[model samples]
Target: MRLNDCLTPAATAIRRKAASSRELRSNLRASWGDGVAFGGMVGFGETYLAAFVLAAGLGELTAGLVGSVPLIAGGVMQMVSPLLIRRLHSHKRWVVLCALVQAAVFAPLGYAAWQGSISAPAVLILATLYWASGLATGPAWNTWIGTLVPPGVRPRFFALRTRASQAAVFLAFLAGGITLQLAGGGPHLMTAYAALFAIAGGCRLVSAWYLYRHTEPSPMPASMRNISWRELLGQLRSGNGGRLLLYLVAVQAAVQVSGPYFTPFMFRKLELNYGEYVALIGVAYLAKVIALPWWGSMAHKVGAQRLLWIGGAGIAPVAAAWMVSGNLAWLLTVQVLSGVAWAAYELAFFLLFFEAIAPEERTSMLTLYNLINTAAWVAGALGGGAILFLTDASHAGYLIVFAASSFFRALALLLLARLPAIEAEGEEIGLRTLSVRPNAASLDAPVLPSLPSQAE
Candidate 1:
């Protein structure tokens, strides 16, 4: 009887582990499906919010603000994710709800497109809803999925997932651009936008369905506990993580000074058709995609910190490079350089900063970080908007904002000086095992330093 009792417990454990392994495999596949569908939503829908604002006759300032400002509302709303998850007792449920809401947001956008006009207030409100729902999904989803994906596989798994996501983003974006281009300079342009947004909404719904398909092994991991301000503040203090966060926020602020206005600049001042605009961005997108493997290899050879320096230096002059020429060829050259630079910068931080956060605190830390990051983004965009407002959104005004962005980016590099290297969370990384890197489609947003790598 004693031997039988002992053997019984061991047998039960074996069965449990086998069950877990099966679920893990299932969850990983679901995540890939989710990635592809989510990428489709982002590509068809999220990338064009500002351009839509411009097409709606909202003027340049409004177009610029649409991309960065609503993010603050999203950030603030996501702060409640932990409490919501605690009450719901299921991260999966909360995430699915958020994703569904995000999908729904595009419906009204499509409607507004059909109408061919939406007030600035109405547009901002819809954007806030869109961003709020989208941002809320990040923290909870990160905490939930972290448990599903084993640490050993995280680097490679996320890399492959990122590749899938990027591929979808590129294809959907290209299709949307082509549709708009085909519409030509005519009344049907808004109709094309409507169709794009509707398709985007559907893609997100499919993404949510896949999220539902994921098996939540643990409804509440120990990591989901409340984090005290003392702990939060400790994470933000002037250590490696803190300095890195601050530097990243600064860089975001610098980047946004001109980032949000580029679309309008292309449409208005440059007089580029949708095809030319898409071509410019597509070149950059393709460049970034092709360069990722190379950047990953470089990171392995030189270490992530050095990689960060290389990327940082590469990006600083990019905005200013815009002032050197308005010629399409020159702009395309700049974008190729821009794509390669951003890939390195984004990958370095994914390795160094994201990996440094303890898994136990990642949920709360990222939730809070989202708020601060969004605020910085809004501040910089507002600064540039003010410049454009004062200068009447002229070509010279655009040039000024672009120059200032580069200047600030150069100044922000001061913080990166003397930074301590933090250990990465998993194994050595390359294209073979690197984390997420945003494609050019991500440029429409503030590109907050927080990893879409984790929450995305």
Candidate 2:
């Protein structure tokens, strides 16, 4: 009869539900669904933004810059995330908002396609928004999902989730390529792009829905901590981690030098149609997917440091390999090799870098790394663009940039050599970070801490 008795029942009813077996199972399904839908959005829509730029007559220069330059803005924009997350103290809410914003970015692109053209500036703006929204979600989603997925099963669960997501990415990307090919590769392809963007936007919305369905702990995990630049720099200066980070960033820079321009080269100089272009990209992506498990196993045996040497050596020549001959068969072979090289490089990066971070510091650390990494990316891209601009965007110009990329990649190996040996953990899987790249798929640097090592 007491008021305390009446209030106690209401309080208990409002309490957070225990993560019972059924709830955990449900969360797992929702998380996997989110991966598939997110991958669909990436493949169908995000992957083709540069292609869409070219089709819209935005100029090869613009198309070439599309992939790397905007990432600078996106990187800057994502820096706001850790701050906002600290203020709001809710990773889920921040992540979902970013996802929705990412979905909305497609609308303007689709509208431009409907209008039959878009300016170079407009393409840049839209691309910035897309990257901004997408990048912002990375740090938050990484933290949020760690709490949802139990560490005991984290390795197996994420491995399966990654495979499923990668499959979705490949299938959707292939479908988009086919659709664009069928829609007519020349002037009339705007409608096809528009439709792809629409579907891609819808996929992102569905991804957001599934993200919302995942259970957030009643009070969010207290692992979000601000890592000061001074402290981070001190940490970098004090260990082999700095050399490793330097090497990775340099590799990215070198890769971007040739990376963004490859698509425009395909569309213009090579005169490859949508189908052939898609085939090349798809081959690279499939090869990467297939090679990753092998790379993971190699890491366990030979250690990540050895894996880095293997990957770095292979990757150094990849961009330059394009100059060997532009024959489709040769190109496909190059793609397969490139994919394998990249898979090893990326896995080694995760094992060496992400494994070293404290969970509480991950969000901030990743934010800082994103900025440094993307700066290298933009610088490399701008360097490539300058060469193309100076050479008048000729076929020979593409080769020059490719050679330059290889040169820088080779230089990055010097840094790699200075890297101290890292003992590989015997974990079943490394941390997975989703990144969308043109003409290929591979893991990027981890934007989250390793799950198996999270503080209880």
Prediction-by-prediction clash tally: 0, 0
What is the per-residue lDDT of model 2 for residues 1-456, given as tens digits with 9 covering 90 to 100? Answer: 865466666575554344367789999999899989988987898789888888988888899898888888767876777678767778888988899999999999899998898888888988888888887777778778877777777777787888888888889999999999999956668889999999999999999999999988842676566778899878878866677888878888888888899889998988999999988988888888888888877777888778888988988888888899989999999898988888887777767776676667766778777788888889988999999999999999999999999999999888887776666563335334355564353435452434345522
Q: Candidate 1 local accuracy as lDDT?
A: 0.78
Q: What's each prediction's TM-score?
A: 0.89, 0.93
For 1-456, candidate 1 gives per-residue lDDT tens digits of 665476677797997799888888899899889888988987788787888898999998898888889889878987777788879999999999999999999999999999898999999988888888988777677777777887667767776776787788889888989999999868999999999999999999999999999988788886456787578878678457788888888888888898889989989999998888888887777787777768777776787788888888888998888899889999989888888888778677657765666656666776777777788879999999999999999999999999999999899899999587655422223221111112242432211122334433
- The lDDT for every candidate, in the order shown, is 0.78, 0.80
Residue 130, model 2: Cα distance from true site in angstroms: 0.7
Give the best candidate by lDDT. 2
Model 1 segments more than 4 A misplaced: 1-22, 421-456
RMSD of 2: 3.3
Tell how far residue 148 is off in model 2, in angstroms.
Answer: 1.2
lDDT: worst 10-residue window of model 2 = 447-456
